[model samples]
Target: MANPIKIIGASLSQNVRKPLAVAHHLGLDVESVMAAPGDDTIKAANPSGRIPAMDDNGFHLSESVAIMIYLAGKAGNALYPEDVQTRALVNQWLFWDVAHWTPAYQPIQFERAIKPMLDMGDPDETVVAAALAKFEREATLLNAALDGKDWLGGGEPTLADFAAGAGLTYAAPMELPLDDYPNIKAWNGRVMGLEGFKKTAQGQ
Candidate 1:
């Protein structure tokens, strides 16, 4: 309905997956570019040369979360919400994902996956250990938030769930000890059950 929005980023990129997942959740038609940092064409689309840029009916947007929010608005406000306070809370989690979660897990993912591909896999174990520790701490906080709620905000999952889950995708394959936090483990399963989540992960 929104002119088959274009998503520029690799399927495996967590940031890229954010908007991809959101689009799938909205049941919107889309075209993916599968761009990466080394791609010249993608560099042209985004001068700063980041993956996960988007072109929505000629309205171009970059930054993963921004693209997700734009698509969410187009998909209608269900994923966002009209309530001012709730919207603010969603924004808070989104900010937390970018500021805290991304910085923590992204580096580890890069070190484990991308770096090896580039033959730059030499990583400082101390740094990886610290990042993982921080991730665990934050995950505990997320577990607390999910204590008895069916979703992050309330009954229905919201952008907060999407945002948090996107950052945590890198941890899934690693089989992080999520069982310790039953609530968070359940939340992860719920997120993975979403069409958007599954599609972005390129899963059946």
Candidate 2:
């Protein structure tokens, strides 16, 4: 039997949730090695010291998207998909998350949630306002894409869902005000309702 996959990051992280969600969804024997930022142990594996690095045997991999793709390949599931077109669609959303979706949500999450937790001070209303504008614009685009679909990539949940929905993992705590985007809210409901998402991402 292969060694269990190692997830190197704290469970609280948005990026860590992606690969963790995929692993749980596939019923993989995965373990979290919980490293906070600046942990030299994790830095050795990923120079960036980023959360959510994966170690399968001795092969180390970083970046949540890359980690999810690798995990999906191991599980031989449709999460990443084998069909060229399907994989392309998943990759497109994954790239979109990194490029657009996450950037808008990160600032809001940091200000509204993480700061308060760390006693870092109150949220900057100006920063939250700016992020709210961006979030509204992006949420509209995303809600349209998810229209009449349970998942982003297609009928079934895929890596795209995990990557694209990572920010929503913080939605409740960050107070994202998702009432306007019914499609997005419903899609997130389905994703969070998954047994895997519940156990790994929702701590249920």
> How many pairs of residues collide in each model?
0, 0
Listing every candidate in turn, what is its Cα RMSD in Å to the true structure after a full C-alpha superposition?
A: 2.2, 1.3
Q: List the residue pairs that clash in candidate 2.
A: none
lDDT tens digits, residue span 1-204, model 1: 346889988777878888888888998888887777758756666777788788767777888889888888885657898899988988988998888877877767776655665688576667678777987888888888888897877879788888888776866544366778899888888998888998777553
Error of 1 at 58 (Å): 2.0
Compared to the true structure, candidate 1 yields what TM-score? 0.89
lDDT of 2 by residue, 95-152 (tens): 9999999998999999988898789999998999999899888999999999989999
Per-model TM-score on C-alpha atoms? 0.89, 0.95
RMSD of 1: 2.2
Model 2: CA > 4 A from native: 202-204
Could you tell me which residue pairs clash in candidate 1? Answer: none
